[model samples]
Target chain A: MSRESVINWIVLAGLVAVPLWAHLSDEPFTITLATRAVILALAAVGLNIALGIGGLVSLGHAAFFGIGGYTMGILAHHAQTYTPVMEWPLLIEGTKSMPVIWGLSILFSALAAFLIGLLSLRTSGVYFIMITLAFGQMFYYFAISWAEYGGEDGLSIYVRNGFPGVNTLVPIQFYGLCLVALLIVLGFNAALARAPFGLALGAARQVPARVRAVGLDPYRLQLLAFTLSGAITGLAGALFADLNRFVSPTMFSWQLSGELIVFIIIGGVARLFGPVIGAVLFVVLEHWLGGLSDYWHIYLGLMLLGIVLFGRGGVIGMVAGRERSHD
Target chain B: MDLILLAEQILNGLQFGIMLFLMAAGLTLIFGVMGLINLAHGSLYMIGAFCAAAVAGWTGSFTLGLIAALAGAAAAGALIELVVIRRLYDKDHLDQVLATFALILIASEGTRWVFGSFPLFLDIPEALSGPVMLPGGIQYPLYRLALIGAGLGVAAGLFLLIARTRIGIQIRAGENDREMIAALGVDIDRLYTFVFALGAALAGLAGALVGAIQSVQVGMGEPVLILAFVVIVIGGIGSIKGALVGALLVGLTDTLGKIALPGLFGLFLDPAQATQVGSALASMAIYVLMAMVLIWRPTGLYGVRA
Candidate 1:
């Protein structure tokens, strides 16, 4: 295998192996930490499709993330209470099935992305960033005002949602599910990077006029990428909410969005496995530094400065080497 | 609504607009002249509030507190400009955004470490402690009226400085063609630094003025920062005139919508339900307005579309 691919495999193995060992050793806390890292990586991977491939710096991605969380929250809340979602619409009932929640999460977030992208993608550069951030704020305030389903306080799932063959209440089993999900996402991300759609989006990012000259609809291509990106992120959000058994408005905050972007940056933008590395580093730092001081963000801020000012290629670039670029 | 209530609300809107203008003025100036998008501009506002609160609490004089706020924030802005911003001038907006975001984390955490999580207090000056009657028989806070006057005065003074003075001429000239003015022996660096400090001072003044009414706390600047961003974007990013108009429009729309939406919804729904839904929609009113504006004029009202 090539050096970069070798590094990628090593990273993946370490992620899986560490959690499995932790579970085997009865270190459930470590398993939870690994689980959190995996879920955040999944979210960042979704972001990479739009940000890395399409060059869309969506500052409001937390909107979809919160959508995913709320999807799980609303559904599981009803299921726990033995309530139907609604009497109309053929009496749709709540479900604690993980697969069902994941599907709805993807569907709702995709729809939201399509709508937001429609208006927001009309503008580019700073306008796009601000518009997305504004959209996120709009959703955040809406969630806070949503009186039912634990508005400002957030909703809690009494029981962890069930996976078809696994006892997901066990931390390791839940971690395993998340791991499998993340592997699938990573595989999808890698394949998509080589796919025609991804290549076309990359082209559009660099030269929109040239894309149009080739008789391609770059707008539609980007919009589709954004929707898929939202779907994946939404799925991650569902898993995250599940892990905590809680969903709150903070999931939709701009800080969350910024942190997601930070993952992409730290991992190496436009590089496969970049967000993975970034998320791992972040979760680790959050764990370690959080224990050290309440003002740990000071250290994080300094680290971020060093990375932005001096550390190019992020952790991925540092370990895997600079990605060979053609465009 | 009664005329008195309406007038009071309008006055409230004006006060809010002026505060936004103070924030946006500095932001727009920095963008217009330096072509940098500084996300940490909000941190400077926070610094000002904290400084004002600390000084006022220590000395029991709001005027001294206000002075401290201006100097502290301006010094912070200058230091940041020299240490971080100049390097970013030739870089892309992404780099600038990320770097400034890092600064925000630093500023916020540093403040937290010093002051703790609890909010600090800044009392309204004793001279302007009570409500004053307006011409329309509307009672309004005297401090808010003073804020409006200060904002207007700043606006007028800024216009004169930019329009009538020699430095203003140089600033305008530099804006149009930096190299041309620099080649003529003008110190561009000093001018940039000066302009940045001026912007910081304006933001600090706003923070100190508003800190009396609201709790002076960490993270308080972010909401105002976002609103100021909305103002600049609506007014066009680089135009002071645009910032002013956009600020007023946003201030009015946001303030009025909060009052009007719930009432309008009550006509159709029960009072409690109306309130929940109306407030939700009200919170989103300005975003909707922004969307409408973007659709109509993508570059904002006065911003030239690229």
Candidate 2:
């Protein structure tokens, strides 16, 4: 079809083929790396909905990511210890079922996003960026001090959470599950991009006055996008925690949020497979350059600077040319 | 419970706020004039602390070390502005943020590579080391008191420079209209470099002053940077007066909440639970304050209505 779509297909094929090749060759580390990239890409895709589509530059997606991780951590922690999550109002039992945890994670994160968006959406531009960051820091500090759930030291689960008929303990199986999640989300993203809501949201970003002139509520549209964005990211977070078999306050750190943005930027902002390309490149570079020196971040910084300065539309842009349409 | 302890905490809050003002003022000025968000401002703070520590250790003169800090950070700031930040002036906040973020990674890793992992320590000078007796027999660290005086003095100096000097007029003019000032024959590039260095110097001074109280370490600037961001947001971006008020408000809220919240909670809850909950809420107090401020006045207390 189009050059960009061709590239997207090839990228998707490579993501699946690499992990399968690693599994066949008994290279578990590569599979783990692939899994990490997939999870991170999923998180960035969530961000892409707000950022690329709605033009909302949020520096606080980590809050939802952490919420998802902690959801998994708190529930699975209780499941492992056989303790009820709460007993004050009503008994809430901890669950190790991936489906349940995912649902709760999505629900909680969406609720949090709705509240945060209600407040944050009141501001725009640089204020929006700083406010979202402050919100992230708020969650981070709360996580660190809420000592009941392991606090700063974090919580570790001995066994991985279960998905039906899938031995997730095997790295490849887990990677496949993440890939499926990514693919499903990507499909949704593509559909949403073409949908009327997406069109209105895109309009709201470019010209709020015009969006209002057409009787559409820009704020409500953005808030909905932000909420959905948080839900998907929350799902990725649950998956990420399960992959690591641990959850920590570090998940909420501003650095993680920054890295998520970096993934979007590196892959090609608003491109369908941009996050996928960006995340894989980031993981590969991190693995490759990390082995070269302890101070590999210096090189990473230099590369990022070069990209921002000269490389306008990132890797996808360089290869596929400019995007066909603004949406 | 004790009035003296409360008074001392208030003083500590003031000192902290004033130091934060040093950081925020520079940040606000740069943002107001250039419309650039420099995430690496904190890295300049770290550089100042490191330079001060290294020089103080070598020359056995704290004053000289402070001077070295000022010069080093200014030079670094000017160099960065000339090389990287200069290109970003016309870019969007996203590009500005990413580029400056890259600078932070480079500065931090480069500092770690050169200084190694261990934190460098700067000692309080002999003259400012001991406690000073104040009104009502309150004893406070001379160094901290000096920090308050110095921060205020710098604040005053900044106000004067902006209010009275020839460059001050130009700076104020530039903030309102950049192209007009350039068209009026002002050397806009040099002025920008000068302003960036001035902001850098202020941050460096804060770093050097605070470095004595805490360990001079890499990544230390980030937390302070975030706090400074909160201050600017609360004060309304691009306003010096807003930065001052916002900085003090954050500092007081943070410091007082840490102590008062626990005591308040302890009145109702068990001591351990009170402490945990109080401390947690205390940590979040400033953010809550920021949120409330935004709700009340989206443009900030002193910000001109957008």
Candidate 3:
């Protein structure tokens, strides 16, 4: 195996081992933290597809993230309250099933992403970033004003949604589910990175004119990548809401979008396991530094500033030595 | 609808647009001159507000407060440019974004550390506190009118400085060709610092002016910052005239939409649903305006092709 592959294995193993150890040692909080890392890793992995591979620096992924969270929250809410989500021409009922929520979250976010991508893909660079941010703010303000579900206050699920034959209420069980989801997405990401489509997308990112010279539409390729990226992030958002048993408009905030980008940067942009490493490190830092003081963000800021200024390559890049060939 | 009420809303929109122009002008200038996207610009706005509030509270003089705001934000902007932003001018947009984002965290928490969690209040001066009758018999706040006048005055001054002054010539030259200007014996580094400080001073002035109407608080700059981004984008980045027109358009659209949309919707939908839907759409009006503008002219109405 390659050096990076070996490190990836070590990181994955550590991810699984820590929560197992936490469960055995009766540290439920540790398991929860690990779960948080895994879900965040999953979300960042989603972003990596666009940012890392397609080079689309989207600042609106929070719109999808919030869509996913609201999907779960709204569905489970109606289920608990015994109300149908829609009772019009075609009756639609709420579901407490995790699989159903995930499917709907992925579907809704993918649609939103497709539409957002269609318009946003027309522009590149800073315009793209600002447009995406504008779209995110659109969703954010919509959420805050759309009081049918919950306005600025947010909605909550009374109980964890059920998965087939698993007690998701248990912290360790939920952690396993999230870890498996993350690993599956990571594997898909790995496969896609080597696939023909991923190659074209990467080419489009590096040299769009050349990609176009070859008779392929760079815009279409990017739109597909953006859609898939949004779908994955949407799934992670559902899982995150389930973890917390709550969803809020804060999910749609631009700050969350910025944090998602931070994860990709800190992990090593474009690395398969970069987001995984970054997310875990972030959670650990938050926990550790948060214990030290209330103004931990100042220290966090300094660290981020230091990294951006001095360390071009993230942790994975620092260890694995400069992403040999973008393969 | 009363014509007088409509006029009042229009004036309010103009005031808001003027404030946004201050922020957007600074942003466009920096982007044009430095080729850097500084997210920390908002932090400088917050600094101005905080400084104004603190100084005003201590000395009981709003004029002193506004001056302190300008000085404070300009100093902070210069320090940041020297220490951090200078390094980022050559980096990619992504690096610039990340570094400035970090500065935001540092600035925000640092502000909180110094000022505590609660908001500080800044009061309008006695002279500009009350309302004045306008040409149409409509009453408007004197302070807001002053803000409009002041903003327009600054805009005029900026135009003069850019068009008529030696520094303005250098700035315009620097925008066109940095190396050419530097080769002509200009101190490029100092010019950059001065431009950045000028932008920061504008933003600080805006923050102090706005703080009189709203509570001076942490995280307040972000919303306005995003709006300013929209303005610049719609105005076409790197174009001062575009920034001005775009800011005014956004400000008017946002203000009028909030009041007009609900009433318009009330014509079709139930009052309750109209209010809800109208408010939601109103909130998104400027973004919709941006999208439409982009659709029509990808480079913006006045923007040069990128």
TM per candidate comes to 0.97, 0.99, 0.99
- Provide DockQ values for all models, in the order shown: 0.68, 0.84, 0.78
How does model 3 fare in lDDT?
A: 0.92
Candidate 2 docks at the CAPRI level of: high
Which ten contiguous residues of candidate 1 chain B have the minimum total lDDT?
Answer: B89-98
Candidate 1 local lDDT, A2-61, one digit each (tens): 666777788988997999899788999999999999999999999989998998988889
Off by over 4 Å in 1: A325-327
**CAPRI quality band, candidate 1:** medium
What is the C-alpha local distance difference test score of each model? Answer: 0.89, 0.93, 0.92
Tens digit per residue, CA lDDT, model 3, A1-85? 7778898989988998999999999999999999999998899999999999999988889999999999999999999999999
Runs in model 2 deviating more than 4 A are none
TM-score (0 to 1) of chain B, per candidate?
0.98, 0.99, 0.99
Query: Which is better, 1 or 2, measured by lDDT?
Result: 2
- Local error of candidate 1 at residue B261 (angstroms): 0.7
